[model samples]
Target: MQYLKRYLLICIAFICILLGIIGIVLPLLPTTPFFILALACFARSSQRFHQQLLNSPYVGPILADWEADKRIDKQRKKQIMLMIVCSFAVSIWLLQAQFHLQLLLIVIMFILLFCIKRIAEK
Candidate 1:
């Protein structure tokens, strides 16, 4: 039903926003994608929630810019790259003797870098 769909979207949005907040302290979980997901869900479910997300201090401008331009600022792209590197470094260092896992992590890092390269820089 329409109400059920709206409720699910709002729930998903809230969960994604929570994950985005947690990603602040946890390096492995990239925050922007989750925040972007939340924004989309909120937009479909509730204008007020969408506006609140748009007004957030740290993420607001980034979300607005992304929605309007589908582009990320140069500094943010660099930061994302740095975060990716640090996350992989930490994961590899912490998972000692897991050769296969380490290799997979390296692959993931490369993929992340490749994706990062594709994002338009402002």
Candidate 2:
């Protein structure tokens, strides 16, 4: 049972990591949350995998900041916010015929901004 649980967690962790990678290209999705989830799973299931994740160049620093203080640095926060705005703006503009979709995108963008704002700065 314990082994099965560990295997399940490891699988989930890898899936989350893949989503995090995809989130890098898809602005509507967020990367940090997925990466963080993966990190949490790895921490619980496998120390080696957790350390390997921490050693990743692209994701390590962000996770390290989150782990240390549960907050992102001001600069990184600004960058994320900027990316969200730009990507959402493009998406909203591209879907001109769909007013409802545009509105939904706007709402999602604002919600994302709000969530980012609420995260305490490190």
**Per-residue lDDT of candidate 2, residues 48-104 (tens digit):** 999999989999989988988899999999999999999999999999999999999
Q: What is the C-alpha RMSD of each candidate to the true structure, in Å?
A: 1.5, 0.9
TM-scores for all candidates: the values are 0.89, 0.95
Best candidate, lDDT = 2
Q: Which residue pairs clash within candidate 1?
A: none
Q: All candidates' lDDT scores?
A: 0.90, 0.93
Candidate 2 wrongly placed segments (more than 4 Å): none
lDDT of 1 by residue, 12-76 (tens): 99999999999877755678889999999998999999999999999999999998989999998
